[model samples]
Target: MKIAFYGSSLVSSYWNGAATYYRGILHALARRGYDITFYEPDAFDRQQHRDIDAPDWCRSVVYPATEEGLRGVLAEAGGADIVVKANGVGVFDRELLEGVVARARPGALRLFWDVDAAATLDEMRADALHPVLAALPDLEMVLTYGGGPPVVGAYEGFGAAACVPVYNALDPATHHPVPADDRFACDLAFLGNRLPDREARVEEFFLRPAASLSDRRFLIGGNGWETKAMPANVRHRGHVYTAEHNAFNASPLAVLNVARDSMAHVGFSPATRVFEAAGAAACLITDAWEGIEQFLKPDDEVLVARDGQDVADHLAALTPERAKAIGEAALRRVLAEHTYELRGAQVDALFKAAMAERRVAA
Candidate 1:
């Protein structure tokens, strides 16, 4: 099978949260004998500041951020077995979705994969006439990162023929335990691009905790955070690149996962950081979110916190042996059931089932 995916930069995680998802899933699909081509706009300086070299498994195209560029890519995607327009593509997504669904081969599966389903659904609900809702009936299927049952039901309610939640998972080859590095060593570490939806949660879950734990070291990674005033005990390091993830994860005594307000409310949504931290065998701490227990057993495989006090308490109570045991358990859980290979196979099965049903309907 040949697949065409349009998304945020596949080569750079710079300000692109979906980069890991794209890279891991596409690489896995390619390994499963599916030919893959990725199309990303050259906007956001992502191409110039790429963090990873081009993968050998797929063709990566950096196109002009214009209408002509969109048309050209859509044309190239004509005969693909699957054509995907993912959310957060950093372009006019409604326009891209329309073009791809309209131009893709009749037998091809035209999918709108929403890596940020919560935000997308919120927009759709805010306006009944949103372009995505208008276009939903035409697409073959819809997929999401972590929206779970609520997200899938919302998309289906919006007139989608089929909607599925394809959660994020770890790539053992890219994100596994590694030797710790001194630079990232800290009592707690948090990594995420600063965005409005997540800023408040970061303040509540990360910054506040740092303030309370003045004796402990807190390291913050990702862009747009350097300007913010933080506790004296906290260190803000701008834009930790993908290549440095293992070291960053290993360096921290315990890693933190703070979900954006949208994702937190939706529940069952685990961000890439959650799996990345687990893959590194870092004692994991996350703010409370529903459906978290389904992924990792709370208080056993992972620690859950509802506020700054909860986080501070977890940090204060953690001992070396207990932390190590928790990290090991989380790593085992992810490696066994939450790897990219498993996710890729699930997506392939969904595509096959959707296509087969389409055939029978025809």
Candidate 2:
């Protein structure tokens, strides 16, 4: 099967949080005999900040961020077995969505892959005329990186023929434990690009704890926090490259996963960082959110925090031995139940079933 994936930069994680998810899932699909061509627009300086060169597993096309470039890619995608217009491509998104639905070869599956389903759903709910809502009826299926049952129900309500939540998972090959790096050493570390929807939560969950725990070192690695004021103990390392993520996750005594306001409210959405930290066998602390127990056992495989005080409390009691124990348990659980290989098999089955249903209908 051939897949034409139009998304934000697959070669860069600069301002694109979905890079890891894209790489993991697409790589797994490639191993399962799907030929993938990832089309990413040359926008947001992501081309200059690329974390990885194009991989042999998939052909990556960096198209100009222009109407002409989009038309070229849409024409090229006509032959694919599956045409995917992922959310937040950063340019010509609506055109790409409508293009794949209208121009994909007859019988080619048209998919809308939403890496940020919670935010997308919020937008759809606010505006009935959202372009995605208009495109849903024509799309074969809606695939989401997170946002479990709520997202599926919302999409179905919006007239999507089918909606499936393909949660983020560990790619052991890319994100397993590595020897800790001194550069990222910290008591608690968080790596997320500063964004409006997430900034307040980061302040509440990460910064507040840093202020309260004056003795414990904290590290923040992401773009846009360089100018933000932070406590003397907190170090802001702007834009840690994906190549160094394993070290970043491993060097920290505990890594924190703070969902965006929308994701937390939506309940079941887990950020890519959660799996990345667990994949590196790092003790993970996540802000309280519904459905986490379905992924990691709280206080055993992971620590759940209700607020900044909860985060501080966890650190206050954390011991090297206990952290190691929790991390190991997380690793075991993810390796057995939440790996990209397993996710790939699930995706393959979904694709097969959907194709069969389409054939029957035809």
Candidate 3:
């Protein structure tokens, strides 16, 4: 039951959007009598950005996280029953990854939990460090937060013993619907950090709608959005953290999701915002992607928009009551099947299977 959950600074929720997802799943596992030791590189004080810290559910070990420091820390993981090395740990290089593999105790589970599967696989395919994934047979498991079926296929194709898609799910305790506030609410708002790929999509899908409905209000939030010569009606609020995110969503009529380059291209990567928006009972309008309908019912729980005209149409067509109904339905779906607790249970099941196989081998 002793698990070494090694990854980024879950201590901070500021820039690290994955914090709640980690916390929800790990905390749920802890309640099941699993003893978790969360190892994080003591980087920026994530506590400064968020209102909380590692809950009493697990023990957190903050290491100095230099190359040498990681060597020392990886050595500490030897005693645990499972050691999970998630991508985007924010303190990784070949040395840390290789050292963990070399130093990992045989019989103890090792997981390359790729939170960003689409991007990570791309990195593995292109880089000299590609052997990192090919060495999966030596590890116990491979888990992904998104990429659903495509992720599982790729890992097994590469000769992995096991690959599981542990897609992102809701952490209902922290993400529930908030009361819609008129002052903060808008007919449609898009909240995402500005990225080159997303910027183009935003212009095509979000900005155009805002411009089309000049009489209506539109709000944009997230970091790296300064370059956009946004319309005056499109208010840009830079980098709203977890605390502010719910209010931001509550203030909007429907929140738009523009996937980043890696995710949009991959077709299965839904951002944390998807669940958050749904959980908050805020209507969601997302760009068309092949795999989206699997998670949400288009024109029902979610509105699929491929262009600015589509977005404008959704805005003009839907009433508040209907939008509320969609948000509620999406929330029900998330709560039923998409929570982080469920994702963690999925991880535990894989561990159980791996351990069972090990026993059979013995």
Candidate 4:
């Protein structure tokens, strides 16, 4: 089957946190004999800061961030078995959606893959007349990265034919225990891009913890965090690349996973960082979220914290052996159930079922 996916940059993690997730799922699908053509706009400075070129697994096409570019992308996507307009494409998302839906082949399945379902749903609920919200009913299916039943129900409420979550998973090949590097070595580390939706939580979960535990070493990795007045104990490393993730996770005594406001509010949304850190065998401490236990058991496979004090307590109580055991257990759980290969299979099945239903309807 041939799939056309239009999303954020496939070649850069500069401002794109979904890069790893995209690579994992697409690479797995390609390995399973599915052909994929990824379309990404040349805006967002991603092209200037690409970490990867076109991988042999799939064709990566970069187009201009203009009207002509949209036409070209639409033309290229015309005949695919499936066409996906992923969330956070960083340019003219509504326009892209309108065009993809209009120009898509009659038999082709159109899907809206919401990497940020929490934010998307919140916006959709707030703005009933939003073009994208109005367009939801026209799409074949809506997929999300997080939010369990509640998210699905909400999308269905918005007139979607169907909605489901394709949760983030570990790409074991890329994330695993590696020899620790001195540069990233710290008592606790949190890696994420600085975004308005998540900055407050970062302050509560990461910054406050750092302030309380001034003696313990802390590291913050990702872009756009340099301007924040972080505690002295917390060191900010701007934009840690995907290539450095394993070492970055391994070196940290216990990594932190702080969910964005929308994700935390809606629940069941585990960020890619959660799986990546767990896959690396890094003991992880995350803020309390409703469906966290579905992914990682509290205090057994992972540590759950409700506030800065909880994080501080976790850091203080973390012994080398305890950390090792927690990391091992989480890794075991992730390997057993959460892998991109598994997600790829799930996606393939969803596509097949949709096609089968379409055939029966015809």
| lDDT top scorer | 2
Instruction: Please list the C-alpha lDDT of all candidates, in the order they appear.
Output: 0.90, 0.93, 0.78, 0.91
What is the C-alpha local distance difference test score of candidate 3?
A: 0.78
Candidate 2 wrong stretches, greater than 4 Å: none
Q: Model 2: per-residue lDDT, tens digit, 131-238?
A: 999998888899998888888998899899899999999999999999989999999999999999999999999999999999999999999998898999999999
Candidate 2 TM-score to native: 0.99
The sequence of per-residue lDDT tens digits that candidate 3 reaches over residues 1-362 is 78887777666665566776777778878877789988777665554565466668789887786877787778877888887777777666455566556766878777777777777778777874574565676777788777867777877877777777776677887888777666567778777767665778888898888888889888887767777798888877776777666777776778888887677877877888898888888899998876997788887899998789999998999888988899989998888878777777776677788889988888
What digit string (tens of lDDT, one per residue) describes model 1 on residues 228-343?
99999999989889889988988788999999999999999999999998998989999999999778999999999999889999999999899999999999999999999999
lDDT of 4 at 127: 83
Clashing pairs in 2: none
Q: At residue 127, what lDDT does model 1 achieve?
A: 97
What TM-score would candidate 4 get against the native? 0.98
After superposing candidate 1 on the true structure, give the runs of residues whose Cα lies further than 4 Å from its correct spot: none
TM-score per candidate: 0.98, 0.99, 0.92, 0.98
Worst 10 residues of 1 by lDDT: 87-96
